[model samples]
Target chain A: MTDLYLQDWRAWTPHRETAGECRLDTREKPAGAAVPSMLRRRLNLLGRAVCDMLATLDSGADSIVLHASRHGDGERTLEMLYGLNDGEPLSPARFGLSVHNATVGVYSIASGNRRSQQAVAASGGEWAALMAEARGYLADGQPSVIIVFSDQPVPRRFAAYAPESSSAAVVLRLGRDPNPGARRLSETSVELELETATLQPLDIIDWLMDRRRVVACPLSRRSWQFPAVRP
Target chain B: MTTTALEHELKEMIIETLELEDVTPDDIDRDEPLFVEGLGLDSIDALELGLALQKRYGITLESEAESSRQHFANLKSLAALVESRRQK
Candidate 1:
């Protein structure tokens, strides 16, 4: 089990009317105010949500960034596929921003952050991978690591092959040192094993907002426990 | 010398293709640079604009040709290129 301090967090969802302390205006898309107009134009809804959530958190310039997504920019990929099938030349902008790391790359560029950035797209257990990555960074003596998890529902073409999911994003700043105002987060392995399971962004948001003690993920056979908010 | 209908249309196309929300047809100076200085566009925008031109006008640029860079240098050059080369 590894214990880490949750220095700060912000979450967003298109379906939910409220996400903990952040109340998103459902009528309009997230403006991504922190990102400049030039770069912001490249982001889709999910990317914009991630940027908006990150803007609310104290993401330091030197902190390392770890971004995980189950379905990274499926719409853009689908568009390119259609163009290819029709023998139409692909849009260079779409092709350039189609990579899994493109969202975080845009964020890094907009924020002028030269720190280390890692993008993960695990088949499952992406949340666990993110937590493990954050823990590893903390153990390596990094002051703080910014962990972002964002995913959107697969495009219509891939809906049959994928499970149903809503668009959501969660950004957390994890640190080794505990702060009195921060929440305490720890990971524990559970004996119950499942064949395929992954913690969703909504799971983390629910755990953080509600008075829940344990959020379990059978996919990874691990559980994250929010022991208490430090006083 | 003046902004022609095609130039106006090209400006609108540039704004729409790049999603330059803050810019309009009137904002694009025909003789000014479209990249790296006046409009502050970068390589990605250049590629995007090239794709847009290809789709709309069947215009294809040789990536290594010096003339292609000159054609993309300003809106006036782009308009001139389109007037002489546009297929559609």
Candidate 2:
């Protein structure tokens, strides 16, 4: 298992507390100062969500960025495809940001971060893969790594095939070398036994913020144990 | 449609199609450029606005690539282009 410090973290979701229908809103809401207006205007919902959390974490300029998303920019991808089907010329900005790592690129531009960045996605084992990637960065002697996991629900046409999905982002600033041998248990030591593979990153953020040392999330089979916090 | 009314409609279309929030048609200046300097739009907005205008005004810019750039210079130019084409 990877041993790393959860130095800081932040999470955001577009859903407002409401009794109305559950759906994705594509508006580019103001996230933070990390993204300037010129760049912010170009970001789609997923990019804005990712940047919102990243800004909150104050991610290091040198920290490696690992953006793991099961469905990266799903809505934009669908729009591009539909535009193609109708023989319409796609917007250059949409085409530019539709790539998997586009959000990470935007983050780099916003924060002036030139460190190594990687995009990871898997039908299963996404979190596990993210952990492995962070471990690799630490082993390479990097000071820290930022892992931003974001996802948006698949479009309605593909909703039938996908599990329940929503738009959310989680940014974690992790480090292995914590202040010259601090003996605190690493956050990586936490074990989450999840029943379903569909573990939303927001659940992990909630668990980290709560006072509880262990959590069996209500709507999920994910049971997490945080031995790092034990006195 | 009058130029003033068409300009208002263009502003609304720009805001809606661009997904711009906290902005209204009254906020847009008829003489201000829509790209880069005035409205701060980029090439992507130009493409989106072109599509919207084509659909709404039932006009085509197929034969006028160079003039299309001129038409998109500002709200007045865009309205003039739309009005000129709508009368045809």
Name the candidate that leads on DockQ: 1
How high is the lDDT of residue A99 in model 1? Answer: 95
The digit string of per-residue lDDT tens for model 1 on A165-194 reads 778888889987787667787778787667
* Model 1 C-alpha lDDT per residue in residues B1-88, reported as the tens digit of each score: 3449889889899999998878878889988899988887889898888889998999999878899899999998999999889899
DockQ, all models: 0.77, 0.33
Residue A194 CA displacement from its true place in model 1, Å? 1.6
**lDDT of predicted model 1:** 0.81
Model 2 lDDT at residue B44: 69
What residue runs in model 2 are displaced by over 4 Å at the alpha carbon?
A: A1-3, A13-33, A41-46, A59-62, A79-83, A86-93, A179-198, A210-231, B58-66, B86-88
Q: What TM-score results for chain B in every one of the models?
A: 0.93, 0.88
Q: Candidate 2, residues B1-88: lDDT per residue as tens digits?
A: 6778878888888988886765778878888888888878877677777777777777777635889889998899998888888633
lDDT value, residue A150 of candidate 2: 79
Model 2: how far residue A45 lies from native, Å:
4.9
Instruction: Report iRMS (Å) of candidate 2.
Output: 2.4
Q: Which ranges of candidate 1 are over 4 A from the true structure?
A: A23-28, A193-197, A228-231, B1-3
